[model samples]
Target: MRRSVISGLSAALVLTSAGVGGALLAPAASAAPASPALTTGVADGTYVSLKPTRMLDTRGSYLGRPLNAGEVYNLKVNGRGGVPSTGVSAVVLNMTVTAPTRAGNIVVYPKGSAVPNASSLNFVAKDTRANLVTVPVSSDGWVSIRNATGQTHVIADVQGYYVGSTTTKPAGAVDYFPDDPWRALDTRTAQDGPALAANDYLIQSVSYGANTANISALAVNVTAVNPQWTGFLNAWNGDENAIPNTSNLNFASRKTTSNMVIVPVTHGVGSDGTTPVLNFGIGNASPGTVDVIVDVVGVYATGDGLRFRSVGAPKRIVDTRTSLGATTLDAATTRTVTAPSTVTNSTTVALVTNATAVSPTAATYLTLWQTGVTRSAASNLNPAAGQTVANMAMVGLSDINQFDIYNNAGRTNVIVDVAGRMDLSPNLASGAAPSLSTRTAPKALGSRVATLR
Candidate 1:
């Protein structure tokens, strides 16, 4: 039997003065010099907040000219947010690309490389869109953003950074685990069944037994559907009272939209001690109600089996649109896609691909899973009739070094760009076993539910 990808919030606008300004702090004297090979894992999920600093703008003479089509802009990431240039691995940012003269997408990757065929944001001509992006910084502390269409303006606001070491350790001693996409919270049928009221908030606990053990953060895809009014969604640690001006994603009233977020989990736990729970506060930033769906794509823990590695740039790995010697995938059909040997190794567990569907004849969603395995109940990308839609999918690979992609609706041409991969090797040399005494695996919730109120 094929595995099914099971299908699966908003609150108020209390304007808290969370300023987006900050001075670049000098690197800590005691801090180790940054290393290109070092990949440090955050066990306690410690993230230092930096004032949302603007790093780039292509409009209004910030760059002296609007970004031209196919142009790449390099932005320095080191020394921002108190992160020194030498030791940083990844940075958390709120990136907004706007004012495009024509419809196109942007791809963000490390500097000094070819632009990956992947896309970070897709916009209509002259429309602005923002999304939370966690991108890897190159050893030189720079990242590159490529504009794929007409001239446009780009904005990046720094929030935090992750530091890692270069040594080797046991497989499961990393900071994040990229799980097969799992639906954890669905507000439509939750106790708060229905929609999140305007200016209201939803506090949801994300705990999935064993999988969430020692989890300090979660990499989730939050989707807002059937919003009653035009608004945005703000997600943060539920225990905090102040809501940052940062938004996960914006949506028009009655439209469905999704964005990726990497939020720190709360420190509370159940009696078993292993069931650590993270309080996710979802705030509705519009005047009406909206329903939210939360899906866990990965978790950051102190110990782990796989660590993330950012590629030099995103590359086109699969394009059923004829780029990779493939044909359009028909409705209700599954196609197996393989990564290049240069990209996949013995320890490779997953590949991050931006899957886009174009010219669809009907409404449908895409499901991806390891090859030879039943299709997961999770959907990776959704497309509407005669429209082009894209979403990032982190697909786990089976031993066969291939994964399956399934389209549930009309035949559509699919395009996939490989951005990065998660592998089983640790960055550092063998280290002491991570102390798991205080950590317990997540406890299963018979029916994953979210409290609506």
Candidate 2:
């Protein structure tokens, strides 16, 4: 036996095609009509909407007025409306549009005035054929409907699968919606709520530079020449070759100054040609100090300065210097202090000592539970869901004092290791990532490396 499916406007079912032959015949008088498609033509809520061929009318009128044929009519919706998206193969309408009107009926004025006429219908349809099958209607009303008959429940299925961001999601179709907030770039500037801008505590590289001098000849001068500090000043100002012929030197953390500063020193040894030191002048040059000018045309908040000394040859650190106040980090600040004498003890003890002394007196920052501290605002970097900022620190080792960094951020807490060596053990051990905040605890061996993840 074979099975075939049969559908109609009023009723449709499967009948045995098994040996039953070509087509199924209609029963008799009151049988449902045949349809070539799934949906029928009906009223459009929006400009384009799924419709049924035939409809019913519980209350029959157009805006409380009797409708007639051969008149222009329309339905209005508030927006750019499209097809009625009922995801069914067919549909049914249970409403009446108008009463039958002749070609020339009495004109019914909208403001309730009657005019002489003969047509009795509100609208007329002639060229347009009613569709009773599944059809796809373009937004512009370009429809593809063939010969169809009667009413159909499958008309709703012509909506085609559509995907959407709304609750009325249609499968396998795109949602023609507007842009969302998260989809935008950092226009207002915030990965958090509304306020948190993306910025960092930067040690402005623009304000820092090596002496603009070729620095050929140089000499140590607290007070030892025909013009002692002249050569030193010249060398710093981009003159490598000064009178004394022993002045090639590099400097860092010279002072904690906000304005132009001119410092003269015959102190620290030069690493240039011969690596010479001016061991002459005591009161003036035994210990070198860098002059400074702070806040030189840059974005700053509560300005600060720090003096760091990097050894060129991994030499033992005998002295250190700075220009910031005891608690200040200005370029003019000075620090001529002793450091570890052992090669193995590479930690610089300069900034570490200062930090230690200032620990109790320095202000502490308040950072806790700080994601969107306020409503609709951004806050400090809070770890993403299921993530944490673990093992983060900054270690400024041999790059600062002694021959190495002394301390930096701990595995648990945030700290700065002013003098610690980043290279150590020379074995199989993973290291921290590079970041500004990953300073070693002041007195550990590590570089200013940071860790992410």
Candidate 3:
């Protein structure tokens, strides 16, 4: 007897070749269709802080001299506990560019490619700044950090990485679905409901069972506001033991700050026969209460859909500061911006860009989404008066190859830098697949086997 599996989407198991009377088994479907990606509206955890370790510093003699102005450096990010040396799709790095001899910005992306015309960490001369950056590793296994405008030293600490197949899937085998950034949790005034006291941890669930099954992780913007004292915050999987030496965001007392975070999650039943959940933990390391908020932008999962492609460097896609020679976006104004056709089209579903808000008259935020859709009750970049702030935004696209940008408060200058894009096409040019291994003996149906192959 022959067994065949079929799906409503016209997917089937077919026999390719057989020897004599023997039946042949064809290759399995590359991957299953993924769920439509969207940002979840829920509170996943309260803010907690962890101590951070320095992983790399280009300024010190260890890695040689500081990065020359307008130069790029290739950095390795693997061999950690969460981010294995192999099977890593993308890495979550807390990057800081410091000691700039002149005013400029730093652009981080996949290595060995042209630097995209974008900035990741902006700074004035001698000022130090840090941002949580999620960068896909190049096929050759490194990320590029470029210094734009002036010479500067770069520092990066490993937080985590997105993992993919241990068997046949290549690095960056995961697909991304971007949601209109939505506020999933806000402790201030109990927006999404849970509040936390000092030194407490809260578990949050995002897209566990309702929208899609088998979600391995999420990409989110975590914000901390109104803390009683200076402290840091940690975001991690609820089911795993806390990694005590890492912090996601560091904030001053009574201030509002946000950082992008990539958190791994548990799915389905474990080997112990207990159901698992996509849980996140927020630990408050401050001495007093602090409100926490999360805005989900995207998710990472294995599927027969779009996967990420690094453009080698960050590219400046839109700059509203000079749009039609207009320097500022007036309050309550909405602008339709067409993404360059080179970056998006019918096959591209989402884009990853660094959205910056600078010199606003009043506290303002920027909302980004596909053109023609109802504006989501979410924002991508929020900047305070007289301050320049940038946050990475993962935006979805429609057939129009356009997205809308709306300013929620007083006038502000906006800058959009493209880091990469996600498309439905697979990288068929990646060369030959690794050889496969076979089992010599039959195994029991319910039995478990452990082998490297």
Per-residue lDDT over 290-357 for candidate 1, one digit per residue giving the tens place of the 0 to 100 score: 88877777665553334556655667777777758256888899888777876677666677666777
Per-residue CA lDDT of candidate 3, range 1-453, in tens? Answer: 000010011121111110001111121112322333333311111111112345667765535556776666667655533345665556657877667798777777776666665678776677555677767777645777777776787777776554433334443334443443555566664334344576666666544233234345567888777778777677766543544455666666776667777666544443344434355667777777678888766555443334554544567777766673124688999877777866665456567777777778988777877766678766766666776777777776656566778898898888887766765424211211111111011110121111100
Ranking by TM-score: 1, 3, 2
Candidate 2 deviates by what RMSD? 39.7
* lDDT (Cα, 0-100) at 191 in candidate 3: 31
Worst 10 residues of 3 by lDDT: 1-10
lDDT of 2 by residue, 32-144 (tens): 22222322221111011211111212123212333322232222111112233343221111111222222111111111112212111111221100111111122322221
CA lDDT of every candidate: 0.61, 0.17, 0.57
What is the TM-score of each predicted model, taking all chains together?
0.75, 0.14, 0.69
Best by lDDT: 1
In every candidate, how many clashes are there? 41, 122, 16
Which parts of model 3 have CA positions greater than 4 angstroms off?
1-54, 57-73, 78-92, 97-104, 110-116, 123-129, 134-139, 147-154, 159-167, 170-173, 180-182, 189-195, 210-213, 267-276, 324-327, 425-453
Show where candidate 2 strays beyond 4 Å. Answer: 1-339, 342-393, 399-423, 428-453
